[model samples]
Target chain A: MRLSPRTWTLIILAVLIALAPVTFPSAFYFRIGALIFVNGLAVIGLVILFGYAGQISLGHAGFAGIGAYSAALMPMHLGLHPALALFAGAVLSGGLAFLIGRPILRLKGHYLAVATLGFGILVFIVLNNEAQLTGGPDGMAVEDLGLRAVSDALGLGLRTAEVWYWFMGLVLLLGAFLALNLHTSPTGRSLRSLHNSEVAARTLGVDVVRYKLTAFVISAVYASLAGSLQALLNGFVTPDVAGFLHSIEWVTMAVLGGAATVLGAVFGATILTALPQALTVFQEYEHLLLGLIIMLVMIFLPAGLLPSLGKTLRQGESI
Target chain B: MRLKSTLAVSALAMMAANPAAAEIRLGAVLSVTGPASFLGDPELKTLEMLVEEVNAQGGINGEEVVLIHYDDGGDANRARTFATRLVEDDEVAAVIGGSTTGVTMAVAPVFEANEIPFISLAGAVVIINPLNPWVFKTPHTDRMACESIFTDLTARGLSSIGMISGQGGFGTSMREQCIDVAGEYGIEIVADETYGPRDSDMTPQLTSIAATDGVEAVVNAGFGQGPAIVTRNFAQLGIDLPLYQSHGVASDAFIELAGDAAEGVRLPGTALLVADLLAEDDPQHAVVTAYRAAYEDRFEEPVSTFGGYAHDAFWIMAQAIESAGSTDGAAVRDAIEATTGWVGVTGEFNMSPDDHMGLDLSAFRMLEIVDGGWSIID
Candidate 1:
């Protein structure tokens, strides 16, 4: 039986997750693997906004900052569980995205980008300036998720990061599945239609404004969740998570890996995430290489690595 | 498409199965791939050289040091993640890193909780405060650097100073210290202006400083972009009063990046840059000469005070490890805390439970750039 594109994507993701551990030379790989998943989760949200919905957010890291700080601060101040803090962060990010998206997303093109950038800067400024609560520029400590302790009690012989890696991988898979479903659903079609032409979608009675807002909120939630996971996994939080540079880095990862494809974003996250580790010897050339990669990829593979590669494969089959 | 998918899957599987196993693993979380890359890049160079030197010297007592470094890209949370991975997964002997105070402070608790020795390169007192046993620092804290700068200014009879600093932690800390210490030294700060990190031009701030009454010198408590702005604006605005920069701006890059305006910029820094000026018979001459030779040969660039700090941090850790005769965190911590009279490229580093900052004012020398090189002011 031939699998649909969605099914194939799911199967590929599952196989990749299942096979990742086979190559783990040490438990350190699990930590790195988990990092990739966490970052990939954020990029997956970008796939929904930038790829599926054709919207841009220069400050998605702002949501990530909210998620991270919420996870760090909520438990300490409100006496909530860390997990509940993660949920609260998501809700907060979603609500903020909803409220801000109405006015900011109303602007189009460069204006929208700049507006979002300002929003992100505002978030960063707040997090940094309100150091009394967020630990200022010095950042703050996060409570442990106690996953290792839970595993210890359950007699599971896994390390703390190994557990986090597997758990994050599961989260990524779930995130990817949800994103894929959104891509195939009617709302997804509406979002895509709006991406193609907002005016046309509006004329077609698609409620372009509402759909765009939905996409923004959904992506914000995804980014928030990713940030919460990062805080939980790392056991610390800082305002830099929401900094403008971080937002740019996330966007770079999305576009570099093929924003349109969930797997591609994950691939981009993994490659970019591992590049620094692999290129430790060429530390000086890191920026030159990163700039070159971004320029080269955007110039050569405009559709991104996966989409361009996918096209080539289709062409080969047709031939 | 199927073949590509299969290859990717197999590759990931291969990565997952091969986990690192090494003794005496050292993790570094640095700004290796960001705008702050200038500092992190050289620091990484110094670290790699130190690792090579240590390995060549029979590998940290025959156990072989394995470095697991991550590019935090100057992000604090990412640094924290790397620190966590270093502690929880790599089970590293120690961590040495953080180009920015934000990152260093973010990663400090991880080291504290894991009881891992963490030596921060960033000059933030918050990273080592309240007596975290596992935390040690090589860089002179902002407080020390501020006091040193004020001391130099007072000695030079520059009683009235204008201040400009970025809004970041390093800048704010330096500014606060300058305010506190300037009063102690009977120096009056005439005007204080602050700019955000991304501010490309400080002309407005400099213009304000220039207008301040009786300002004899301008003290810039910032690094990287901020210093570049201050120096350029000082020249452009033609505010010819003497300019004193924080040691954070004491780099060859700062001079080059700041153009002709960097001339006569006074700052408190280690003897690393002006090492060539020291007589060959001087105690610090050999250490500086060797570091300069190795660093320039390897990275094709002049060494900064950062490299000095990096070199000293690793050497201090090595000395502590050797003294402890093992990689035990508590043992290394105790050894480090007990460190006294240990002379290094930066200074004679002395540490105690009450004072984690290894050096005081004596560690720094006031330097003035003349003819495109550093000259120590007697």
Candidate 2:
């Protein structure tokens, strides 16, 4: 029996996640692996918004900031569990996205990008100014999720890094699975059709605005959840999570990895996240090398790493 | 193919491990590329220079020193990851730096978890307060800066103060610390104002502060060009009140940015900034002069106080390692905790169970910008 591409993607992701630990020279690799998964989850969400729906957002990191702060603050303020706080942050981000996307998603191209970018800056300003509440720029510490204790009680016998690695890997897999499933759904088809030509999609009875807004809200939730996971993993969150740079990073990861493909987006996340850790040996020249690599890839592969490679391979096979 | 890939992985691991077992490895994570590079670049250079100096002098206790450093790009997440890598992967005896308060705070728990000595180059009270046994910092805290400035203000009989701080992490921290410590020094903050870190002009905040009743002096607590811009604005607005700045702006860059407007602006800074002004027999004079000369000789730039933090961290770690007599992380942590009366480029460090900074208020000197250079004030 031939497996669908979606099934293949899932299988591949699962296998990679399971097999990654075998090559771990030290427990530190687990931390890097978890970071990759966390970043991959955010990029997968961007695939839905930027790739499938063809919407531009330069302020997605604001949602991430909200998610991170929610995880940090909710436990202390509302007496909610850290897990529940993560969920609440996602819901809050979705609500905020829906409200903003209604008007902002109407814009096209760079106008939409600017609007989203302004939203991110506003969030950053608020987080920075509210020193008393959010601890301002010196990010406040977060309470532990008590997962280690629970694991200990259940005799799971896992290290802290190991727990984070498995948890984030599972989260990324679930995110990818949903994103892949969405690619074949009716809403997904409408989004793709609208992306190709908004006027044409509208003429064919597709609700363009609704689909765009839906994608935006869904992507925000994804970013929020990723932010929550990151804060939980690091045990702290700062205003940088909501800064314009972080938003650009997420979008860059999505585009660089083939935004349209779930696996490609994950690949992009892994590379971008892991590249810095790998470049530590370069010391001062790490930024130079990183910039050079990005430039080279963009120059050679205009459609991004995975898409360009896939097309070239397919063409070669056919020839 | 699997066997081949495994072979490659093992080969790479072996290559990473070939730095010789007798070499005492030290690690550092700093924001060497991004906005905080002004602070981190000098720090990285200082640590590298120190290592070379030590190795040149027959190494530390007959073991060559290896410094493994990573650039965190001023991101907290990157700092955390690099801190973990330094602890778990490189297995260094001690870790240093996170050039900004936010990055240092983010990585503090990692060092605490690994039980490795982490000596921060940043100046934030939170990095050491509520003391984590594993973590220590070189630079004076935001509270100390506030205390020093307030002490000066009180001494001048300028009890009523107006404050203008940037909205960055360091700015906000100093603002709060200033407010919190004002009562202890019998000072009253008559007006408190803040401008965004990126704001080119802080005239509005200064104007408002000047307009407030009983505002005797204005204190600006922020790093980078923010405080410099504030100084320019304060001069432009012609607020003749004694202008005080935080140690966060202890660099030549601030003087250049503020131009003639920096004249008469006072700040409490490390002795490294005005090494030549110190008495001939001063404890820190020798270390500061030697470090300044060596750094200028190598980098062809004026010494920054940020590098002095890294210098202190290096000497403290070296002293700890010498006292501990081993490369063990736990031993180094204990030795660092028990550190006392060790003179460094910044000040004489004296660590205890409660106080991790190991430097007193006297570490900071009152400095004024005369002409275009830093001058020590009595």
Instruction: Give the per-residue lDDT of model 1 (tens digit) for A1-319.
Output: 8888888888887787777777676665787788889999999999999998899999999999999999999999999999999999999999999999998888888998999999999999999877558867777788988888888998999987689988898899999999999998999999999999988999999998899999999999999999898888877677778889889988998998898889888878877777655554566687788889889989999988777877888899999
Model 2: CA > 4 A from native: A315-319, B1-20, B200-204, B229-240, B256-263, B370-374
Q: Which lDDT tens digits does candidate 2 get at residues A51-156?
A: 9999889999999999999999999999999999999999999999999999998899999999999999999889878989998877888889887887789899
Best by TM-score: 2
- Per-candidate iRMSD: 3.7, 4.4
Candidate of highest lDDT: 2
Encode model 1's per-residue lDDT on B1-378: one tens digit a residue: 754754563354232222355457788888877657866887888989999889988877677877778888887766765686677656788888888777887788778878998888887777777667778888878888878877887778888888888887668778877887777888898899998889888898889888878999988998667888788888988887999898877777888888888888888878787787888776788888899899998889777777777888888888888788898899988888888988778888889988786786777888898887899887
Q: After superposition, how far is residue A2 of candidate 2 from its true place, in Å?
A: 2.8
Query: In candidate 2, residue B270 scores what lDDT?
Result: 88
Q: Which is the leading candidate under DockQ?
A: 2
TM-score per prediction, in order, is: 0.80, 0.94
RMSD of 2: 2.8
TM value for model 2: 0.94
Q: What lDDT would candidate 1 get against the real structure?
A: 0.83
